[model samples]
Target: MKTFIYKKYSPRPNILHLYEHVVSIHIHEQLRKMGYYCYVDYAIKAQTHDQGLATITIEVYNSMLETEWSDLLLWNFEITDALIQIAYYQFLAEEGVLFTVKNANLKEELEVEHSNGWQTTKNIDTPKDISGKDDTALVASSKDIPLLSYDIVLNFQKKEVAKESYHDALLTLGHNIQVHLSNKKGYYRSEFSVIGNEIKLSFQVIELLSNTLGQSDSLIATGVIEELIESEALDVFIDAKKARQLNAISISTFVA
Candidate 1:
């Protein structure tokens, strides 16, 4: 398991509550993509003499076991990325909502650091004007929109299948099927020319995980197969490879 420590100092005490909520939601969303659920425990400490100064500490956890720092570093980086975006969005919102409070100047500073001594700090700034922008769209684009890519290979031992058959198989499976064919090595190749009609399909997982939360890689693969079956796409491919049937379908995911 990995741990991240977040500290914030807010001159306006009320902003701490809002900051806590934003950070918790953002962290939970990011961890959900990695098949882990998370919870936050936080506390606010009031300064003894200073009326408006308060310190907040938030602790975040997930289900991953302790592994090499190099492996865990990527996950930490993603969490950090989400924190930065959340801070920016919250700054914009606070600038609008907290403008009425007396001496309500929002001076917020956030510091997030991982266990490995990696740290980042952001000083929230008030936006000049957030008049007509959609907050939901801004947040969705920054965090919820998952841009993922993967390689899927469909193999069949059948001989002399048409090239167009490969195209039809993928189209029947899903929408916006991006197919890149090459005759060169170290690139995606189509068995349409080599043996039978085989296709190397590259596409996003969001389409496959549309019906389900993309918690695990296995879930994503199972969802794709289920969708294909429901659309009768798998049957079409099987009929095309009637001579020998499909040997295997392999998927390897790369999250970007």
Candidate 2:
């Protein structure tokens, strides 16, 4: 079992109440229905409401992968995507109904094999402003294996701070993330690519997490605490692991 943490102090203290387990659980159930499995462990410190500090731990696993490890790292992109949406709701609740928040873009491309052995691709359209994006249903069809590509965009307002924090966090954590599907090696060859804002966001998140919380602390800081306890994404992963015996799908099919 792997653990993820994100610890950050919000400039606006008013949002403190929003970080509670209740809200996290609410979000978890919503995602669970969407096919995510979730579990949350948290503690509240301090006697006063405003002075209290909250720390949460999230553990995730995908039963489909047939491993004791959790896919939360991969699902991070998807759950963060949903968290951004929920944040909008919080934004609205704080503001009035007339106010609007700009949306982020989360473009995704998925590769699948048709029953006839032909490769098929699908593109999903989401809000122009989205935080994290990943392919959710890759192994659904027995005819085709699942090769997924994820893309995520940082909120323009949070770009500078976010980038710094993301990079710092990656350095502190002593961890590396490799999108193997895009690598041109071995049995898998892929046309998939990661550049521009998508790459930028990954770095930014790492830096932000590092600056706010040390390595492991940062993972807990990034609302990941909320994600683990309140995500159905884990449930889906568990189901997927049981359903598909295959390891990750091959990317070589798309090469020209």
Q: What TM-score, over all chains together, does every model reach?
A: 0.26, 0.21
For candidate 2, the 10 contiguous residues with the lowest summed lDDT are 109-118
The sequence of per-residue lDDT tens digits that candidate 1 reaches over residues 1-256 is 2443333333433343334433444433343333332111111121111232222222333223223112232224333444544443333332323222233222222232222222222422233332323222222122243323444444444435555655444443322122111100011111222224343455333332334322353344345445444444345444633423433354443333
Error of 2 at 246 (Å): 32
**How many steric overlaps are in each model, in order?**
2, 52
lDDT scores in order? 0.33, 0.26
Q: Any idea what lDDT model 1 has?
A: 0.33
For every candidate structure, what is the RMSD over all alpha carbons to the true structure, in angstroms? 18.0, 22.7
Q: Distance from true position, residue 210, model 1, in Å?
A: 18
